[model samples]
Target chain A: MHGLPANLEEALLGLVREKLFEGGATLTVETDLFAAGLDSMGIMQLMISIEERFGVRVPESAVTRDHFSTASSLAAMVRRCAAPA
Target chain B: MKALSDSIVEAIFARAAEAPERAAFVGRDGEISFDHLVADVERWATVIARLPGFPAEGVARIGVRCPDGVQHTVLMLAVMRAGGCAVPVAGELPGDERSMLARTTALHGVLSQGGEERAADGSERHEIGGGLRWERLAAEEPCFPVEDFESVCPAFIRFSSGTTGASKGVVLSHGTLRERLDSANRRLGIGGTDRVLWTLPMAHHFAVSILLYLREGATVVLPEGSLAGDLLTAACQYGATVFYGSPFQAALLAAEASERDWPGLRLAVSTAAPLAPETAGAFVRRYGVRLSQGFGIIEAGLPLLSTTGEDPMVVGRPDDFELRLEGSGTEGGLCLRGPGMFDAYLSPWCPRQEVMADGWFHTGDLARWEADGSIRLVGRLKSVINVGGSKCFPEEIEEVLRCHEGVVDARVRGEEHARWGMLPVAEILPVDGSSPPTDGELSAHCRARLAGYKIPVRYQMVRELPRTASGKVRRV
Candidate 1:
């Protein structure tokens, strides 16, 4: 319902806020999601959300600790996944 | 005939005695042989048996709250083997929900690990090894009929997800556990040679998963973490052959970034929620093995499995069980009668005979019979949201939302999701038109009361909620 996020990183931050933490968390582009309590279930939810929202299917092999550490890191992966093969 | 308590304990020990050096559990800590596993379990049982107010001839209800590991398995097995009933208190539950479970189940004590925040009131704490501490609560008479509960030889009490008030928890007996394991293995054919890679939460899946693997003398591989990378590394390190977990985990494994393949994997079973066809397809393409989605009910053990791996929806024919439909049509409420059916429902105290008075347990799942005599789940008759594999009822979430000071009334429903199966969203009617509860406030309120999975992903302000003719909230 709200206006589309300006960029991919902003959009991912929005998604993380709404889905993973249920809008109760204060997050930024560089916040450590794992330190903020992002768990295995949260990772799965974010994976599916990325697929559904951005039409990006993050490969299983791409799910690494660095790629999932922050919103910006996830945004980079999503951008890569969205680019043409 | 041996008593139910002795029978299960003897069965497990007998396996260890036969192959003492066989690895029973392979986790991050290290591999534990069957003999060491049995010895550790016996040590915990000795501690449990000496707890204050432990009944000599009746069952003592003890809650086990721990992360999924060998310690969790040993404690639960110890509780059951020591002639007590084990109730798994999931780690994700908030304090309020935890207290509600304790009171409703009438747990005599709780064993917690990792120095959890709170212990039951009026309880004494004793330090158990492996970071586990047992809190012994003051003796109190149970609200339910204790005699009826003890008569069934209760082994485990699993609180049905989102259940509260009268329809509380499902009770599984020692004998019923044995029967269900036997029936499930008839289809699985798991033996000492199979090494199962375990990822699902032990609290939600112990009855049919870890217990079955241990009883069948199979080695269980507990991954360091549930990530795809961790699972793959564990599988290779432990030489795992069986992968039993939810579709979410399967999806991750399918999309795993590593070039390494799980060549030793013989069978992979997906359960807990319906599997999306894409996930099934991708999994096969990735690993050259089909993902067999199974239909596992807490009331009835795993009765149906999709062995052919053709249609993920079509759960293969019932094994050692009889299935039927509630209506004459092809698609109707699925019902079944078989071994491993739960012994009773705890709070309102309904026995198995009363529950199966009609000779079948209505699964509340809408299903269709395929031409090949397999079963395909169409939908659900109950208003439940399966977020990933965990289930939460809309009514329970609605109750929590209504308690918010800014909300007049609320309605919750499951929204179709691409990955998690279904995610819950809420519509709220505010008490004052001028002001409404902020999303952050509502989220914080719910986070303090419910599990993380049960919290709604989105909230919308509405003037009115759709209702039935009788004025009750009409569910879609």
Candidate 2:
């Protein structure tokens, strides 16, 4: 609820934060999430959460952590992938 | 590094002695309590120790086949107790290789569910497995004087085919074991309440993490076999809270969630290889859980990514070790620096210099760093196929092939040609048992998803593509 976008980003961030907090980190958007903390395994969860929450099918190419590195990038990705208007 | 002392065995013995009726291991064969398991170990370890030839240093070089179901865990601890090494062997390999491995380690003994006797020198044959019996050596249990070992003492050894085509032993020290266990235990919040599903054999480092969970008194449920449906049933039956496997296993679970009952699983972890986007998304949609992928090779320790599911493609961050991508230009490689990395491959041919240049262990995988700096594995460098002048990583193309609705599996390999030098070949495995997708259909599928140069020039509709023992699509 606090970061990213609505329920979609919320669910995504919630899972992200669980791992972030597990390592006792305070991660925000634009943070070098993958390099700073997020790992390959975390990306799998993020993609799963975004699709489940927003009902969007994220292309495998787009799921790379590079797209989600920053809050703005992740938010932009969500806006693009969320089902049509 | 923590030593395998009399204390661990004492704890199991105390638990069993305290509550002889408490369930120790439970599975399809019914539940065997602490009393039964310990009693068996107490009876077996003595015979195991006396088997004449268990090497002196590391306790038990005891190899078990495909794992003897769940009872193998107790047997492992007991072997550790009797000052023996516990070697976990994956049954996916050919019988010849498995047999060679048993003899290569100078095994003290070999155990399996049902098999004939292996002629091991000095080592006695303690047939815990059902069926055919061999003549037992003297059943006298030797009194073991618990000896503390250095961090480098060989606690267990796993055989993996490294850069060389042949299998090479990767020995892990007790320190590395404890380091990984402690890191995963504390960082992942995996403890007594966690019951993990073991789809892969415990002999590998991926399975090594399960031992960490076990030390916390957690339950590990082994899959019935490779079938995803069977795995789902085991997860539900064991009330498994966590699941782990290679990307393929995770994908299959996601692909077939509705067919299997998996309501209790809270965590689904993917490792060993790249996790397809479909696999990650399907699992989350069906189970409301994330199928997290982690970065680790044979040399590096089992690195954990964060739980924060931010992006599917990003490998997330480094774990107990540091991950660095080296070599600039087109040929650079991935490198890892941390405690979990092995000291060296057992092969003395190159020492550790080939992979571990300086302090970093070069991972043959290459990737592009995202803006957030998360890593994405493109594919093995060796698997890169040259399409005319341009370079195409097979994983990129394979991902496209997997996205097709009817395509269940796909393998992209570089094949030599008289004109093109090398062309990409696409091998598709259909969802149904029928023939594979046609060339035109596959072409159309690729034309939509890939670049002009990335598409395969030739398509082969084969019943199956060759795969490694662990089920990875293999290419020369």
Candidate 3:
């Protein structure tokens, strides 16, 4: 699974906007996933976005942190997944 | 901090060396032989041992994010072989959950594919605790061999779905690894010539049988896409004989196949959760495949083909473990014991005495023995939703609703109610393209199927029920 990093980031942002936020416009790097009302089930929608965006496997354990904590952490994790090893 | 036992990794190597040319792995990318796979593991093993922070001694637990396909198995086996425990992951979790489990476990190292553009220290090492990636670990490289290794050591730790709390790590013995592996192999009827579709996630023990597949020279089909279509397509494409899943996975597969036909399937083995009698019956009716539901957990070795008789609720008899019962009512806890079972949970281990009274590990499942000695699981004792002490089991309600003609799936979770304290609520998926059954119709249907108290007080119809990757309905 290979793809562009910027496109991956933009795709992730678009996903948070469309699937997560409904383009309501409040999502940012500092947004609190839990406090913002993104429950575990809602986090699953984010799981799909990361998978679709970077084409990498994010384990269920990852569901607890890095991705769901904040927008910046989520983006960094995604960028890591999208970044070529 | 390395919590796993040692023999698990040795078994992986033993299985690989036994079948060098056999199909060790199958992913969307392609197939690989056990011989080539071992070379890569050894190369990484050598690299891991010398890294500054990597554990060269003591019981060390490591996390690895393996994709749906490719040879993440190689990296894991290498770790175990080098006397390290392999913390298997779903490889599809979000970053936060991934980091949480990593930090919770404090994995010494991490192995991931396609994550890092460059290493933090410019070294090839990838930290497993956080999403620290290195540019070199993903390539096709051989793992270097460790000159000195501890054969008698912990391999990895697994999370147990606790009866009353969030899941905790369960420790297995490298001491009993071989015995456990053998029991699973015997039950699975696995061999080198038999190709296994690695449908279960990497963290599960059944993947230990992957070694058996290699020994027999059989190919493995590792699906890269969604597990939704992978099993069916692989059943036809790989001629999968022993299809494995939890009762829910079996039910979903049967439900999915209800609309189609699957002729290539040979054996349908259900574990993790008890397959409902109706779920089993439907699969046999549609595909003519008998659903083999059994019981398993991280602490105890998963036994095979346990059932009192032909009933799906009858989880057969324990092959490698022991069983016992406590309490009464339509619900009670099912306890188990045997050699392959772990002695106790590492943390606190306080509940050990209660759970291990009389050499049996109380499984906390509401079950009973039938006339023929088969175990019947009603549901989890703790999973009950308390509505002002009018105790209710969600599975019973969901089971009745799932039987509705227009309902393909249903989930019953307890929701906050001002007056009731907690009330049973449901979410449902209609059968095929038809409209979901009306709430009144469903409530009436449940009235006939369950006690008046068990009837759902509220419900909503939707395109699909929320489920985990393994197909179990998620409560929260």
Candidate 4:
């Protein structure tokens, strides 16, 4: 297999760790972002980071509490948006 | 001591009485009429008066800590209505910062809701109505002169940035607020038919925005969220005519996939921070409604607004205010002599006469005049970094960085950004030069101490930070 990243989930977790907060080390794919101190301001910053990292535009509608709950959920949303029409 | 005029809350009451049935606020929870709004404000004001340690004569300084909504608006107005100066304790402040604000302001009490917690130390917490609780701090002597504060009939005490260091507690008197509202409205022209879509936090922008809208008999449309979809939906449903928000929001709405053109939108203004030209361009292209740039500050109200919508940088001619450039040539520090200038600074007790002794309030912006006589901001003379509208000083961040044992010294600077006006970057001189503190360690330490936006985006290891001749850290 090619030396690509394991999955979108891991990439997003890496992003949350590097760009957003320091809780990335303790955070698993299923770790709750809100529990880890993700606030309204954090969500806005995370959205910008996701857009830059994934090379995709997340619609305002996609910014819901559920989709932003965990790294896994965010990766799923990113995958859905990044996929071809 | 100067004699006082009518309060802004009283003016709001008179305006509400003129047309009681009209909608004052239209939110996701439905519309609330002017009469209902007035009634709620009065009821809360009565409740505030009954609270223990409610001042018998002189004005009480009460901190308002609530989520951004109609309730927040009502409680602030109520505090003013009850003859207390309202201080907005921003929800983002850490516990220590909150304690600093409470101590510095010498607050008589704090009206806060659940979710955001500050320990009740030497203060009694009583459950106030409307899911709000009152933390009545034990009465203590304020650091500043109470008579000086009360003489101007103070309405609001707003802090520009962090509580520590060079933070200014800008005090805006009731008469000053009224005067500024009138002056600002000369350009805004918001009237009864207009419905303003509110997006910015009430804690930061209530004095000029929310108060002005209510005073002018306009309905305020409070959106469910800050997202483009929510804003658009609220705007369309509420017949919102005016859109006022930050450039970041304008960029988001511009990038939105929705094809529905909000035809009712008339005047869209981007304020709080500098508006990017790209954001202005995209918004105009998206909605066919030109975006105007507003130049507003804590010390001075909305004085300059770009009316022609030609350039985002050229925040248009002063509205009912006089402006001057401090230095000789075209480019210098922007200065203004205005009707609605702040009354005083709280902690040091500097009055208007002293601060404006030179007959001008020196704004820390470096600007140049265009051929058309419109002012265009080029740079800042101060070292404050504006991350998308929230401001943080370099010294504050450097202090936090220096707190880490590994850091010997640090310097933070605002690096120009394409999207956000600026992003903070740090240079740290480490104790062990061979093994400097990693980004993760620095970030984690900063995250615990400072607001997220104030935290430096990137950390660079250095042997030394440049210093001025006086041995002070050099800032560009």
Candidate 5:
């Protein structure tokens, strides 16, 4: 499966791990971030962090259940929004 | 001054007759004029009157599933006009949960928006105007003996947002509801010239805010969405006079980089949750309008309102209610006896006399009366966690976690945090010796169904959680 680019995924996962899972919780591409303790506020913070890191503004309309479902999903959203149109 | 009609339906009709062209509610669809509202309410009332088993003897309790919109307001009024008690059901509830609510309330019928009406019996569904669907379900089951809502002059029934215990329906009579509106408007002074910018869910604050605004001939403005930009655009475009929102919304508005000021906005009242000092200050700094904190409870309508933004910690003085502390000190259980107090609890059927002691309703909130007569809320007697001012009961989160396939058992608790007042943390036992699901998976499961504040911030795999002798998860 064509998932997020390896480097981008690593960077996103690193941020997720540091901000969301401070207790060294392991994560996978298919892992559900919400069930892993990433809440709505955490999602907002993650969006802000992503915006600052990738220079991509996550529009409010794009903030839905699908966009932040998993690590892979979030990475995909960032890639899609950050890509040159 | 002539005595105002005790019934909200009568008052609406009077207002419609007085000024037919006045806008009662303004939404994305368009403004619903009082004349149109009354006409539409009457049309829906006629449809409801023809429905079978619509309580031939007493007031029928009908469940309304319409979310925050113009149609919801119309449907609620129509239900009341049809001489039935309107019970608002959250549209986001799962099918099973909705059915549970229906059974719990022993509803005569259910009016939903844009969905096929589920029926256990061969009841036919009718398409009502204003994007509403109705079904008569009372005939399928024997009706439970409900209190005579008409006798008590009740206008609506709202369920408590409590997640820990069984949800109890708070019955507010028409008289009490009107009194609440009057008392709140005494402080707010909303008039024909005032246009309120609304953000909170309609189901939660309809009686205290929306109905009150409509009764006073003020216009209610519905934002496109909860986004800070959407709210700002609506407020500025519509010339919103008053902006009512929660602390979360305030924080979002504060965070947005847009350097715009809503010149028409006069007052911004925050309720339905606590207002954080930082959020209040940041919103004032951003919008150049002080965020006034209002202390409102379901049992007792808005009794205290902070008019001046002098102290963020103080929730202002009580206007129409008598407040007393159970124990002497700076802090104690905040108890109040108010004009718009709830008439009764539906399930288990506790009358006001039984629930209230010595004419005072003990608000579970722990608060301190300052030397200056201002009250500051300290904590809650109940184990409800306040996440960034939003109350989330751990029991609800624990119940949601237990529903996960990989979870065998779960216990949720609130951990005191610096930013958000409290953050919900969960400990889970994996099923069948399987590895516990990653935090991402659990949060995804929760975020899909539950509200944002209810989602846990931390999760840990544990063999067992501390429990009392009766096997209740010990919150303390």
Candidate 6:
């Protein structure tokens, strides 16, 4: 629910664009990841990449359709999870 | 080979009574014991019994919109226990498509997820427990009187995945379903000692696999997430013996950098899509297990299986069905006739006789027999692309494209070319969005795996390909 830092959002979008979409796909922070063909497997790969890169663990409960709806939303969730409790 | 009950509900009850404390299904949320599963089924059956349109005697057809997990499994069993045919509708379907299925099936009621129940014009609504709402729709218009097919009692009505075009309901009777489970189990050898790691949507494969697993008293483990790491962990932790997944899932697993051998994995079966030799080889190389393929059709239940896993392309021999190649040479239309075939089609209420010609169901698949007497699937007849008097199968080309490291999924279709009758064009989904192989790189990869004529002339990279509710790429 917390917003992601500007740099973090850019990094997350870049990762998604690279891993889930083709280089030719034009992705923005507002672009719907699911609409762009981000399926369950894609989300899993994204979560793994995010964890490896940012050290944030996304709980299974946090992996709903809404959380991964867009690059911005996913970045926000990743940021929230990564923040100190 | 044993004396199994004809009714799935009866089999479930028997298993529950035999092993009350045994785990029936293990999901991310929690595990359900056989006793708990039976109790849940009874409670939902009581709710169905009180529904308005549920018939007092005969089997009532009801639609269910529930996600794939313990809840969906329970609800389906409940529908069967209540003497109704369970129609499993995908929860993610658009409202229009859902309503169309309800209308076409002439469902007596639909049990959908969420808190509240609303009924429009000709339907009445009631709230069932467990966040499920039941609505009774008006009866379908009388076109022809409903007649029983071969005196077999109907149990489940499943709509085709509709990867190619319009979906049709394939009705399976209780007897037919039981027969399918028995026949497939003989080949699969799943039993009480086995635990299956399930990932495919329950709605798409319930009758053939999930229901069959339960009937055979095997434990089913549903992974918490689709992550390859999570699934591999679940399979190892739960001691899964059999793994049922799609080619995409297998590719993901093959890509994961897991060092430990998946200790308990005895069998890995791929369905719903073609199994690329690259995928099969990678999985076997990574895990030391062959990824067997099964050629399953909604009309005929799991007729062929690669039990030996010797050749990934060879789908092995028929179990219960009598398979025949209808044409000549190495390529011909695959036709089958067997027990446990679909009893009827829902919309027009056409009997099986209407569709069958001399007891053979002409599956739209193009296949050929190997020298070893196993059937190797070429592709779907409708998906063949002819180029300059030569023919090629899209599945063959797509498999080559998928073998590329940068490609995640590929769909090949024919384009109208002025010179060649039809030229094959491909839309590729990159493995990771950042770097996809260029057209030249993909062409080179294809050249290594396929003949020159089979390579796609053009390639378009996309983020994702359109898919059906069942997760197969929708070829439009």
Report the Cα lDDT for candidate 4: 0.83
iRMSD for every model: 3.4, 17.6, 15.7, 4.0, 8.7, 11.8
Residue-wise C-alpha lDDT for candidate 5, range B1-476, written one tens digit per residue? 11235568777677667778988878675888988988888888777777766766677778787767788888898888877789887654545456666777778888888645362234457776666677667553423345444568667888746422545777888877877787888877888888998887676678878788888788888877656767888888888999887776777677764668888988888876667788888888877889988887777778888878767667888767889887877799888887877887766677788788587888888889977788888877877776654566777788889899999888887777644466778888888556679877887677654655566766889887788899877776
List model 3 lDDT by residue over B347-408, tens digit each: 43333444566766766667877776667776665665644323456776777788889988
lDDT of 3 by residue, A1-85 (tens): 5564654444455555544442336666677666655533245446644554457755433443445567667777766655567
Compared with the true structure, what per-residue lDDT tens digits does model 4 show for residues B216-241?
99999988766677788899989999
Give all TM-scores, in the order shown: 0.91, 0.59, 0.61, 0.91, 0.81, 0.71
Arrange candidates by lDDT, highest first: which order? 1, 4, 5, 6, 3, 2
At residue B8, give the lDDT of candidate 4: 95
State residue B320's C-alpha deviation in candidate 2, in Å: 2.7
Instruction: Give the root-mean-square deviation of each candidate in angstroms.
Output: 3.2, 16.9, 15.6, 3.7, 6.9, 12.0
Sorted by TM-score (best first), the order is 1, 4, 5, 6, 3, 2
TM-score, prediction 6: 0.71
**Candidate 2 Cα deviation (angstroms), residue B81:** 2.5
| Candidate 3: chain B TM-score against the reference chain B | 0.67
lDDT of 2 by residue, A1-85 (tens): 2133464444445445532323224665546665553433344445544543455665544543346676557667877776465
RMSD of 4: 3.7
- Which lDDT values do the candidates have, in the order given? 0.84, 0.56, 0.57, 0.83, 0.73, 0.73
After TM-score superposition, what is the CA distance of residue A25 in candidate 1 from its true location, in Å? Answer: 8.6
Off by over 4 Å in 1: A1-38, A45-62, A75-85, B1-6, B53-57, B119-123, B160-167
Once fitted onto the true fold, the runs of candidate 5 whose alpha carbons sit more than 4 angstroms away are: A1-85, B1-5, B115-124, B138-144, B148-150, B160-166, B387-392, B400-408, B417-420, B431-434, B437-455
Model 4 lDDT per residue over A1-85, tens place: 1122459888778767765664457889999987776754677677766654566777655776678889999988887787778
Least accurate stretch of 10 residues (summed lDDT) in model 6 chain B? B160-169
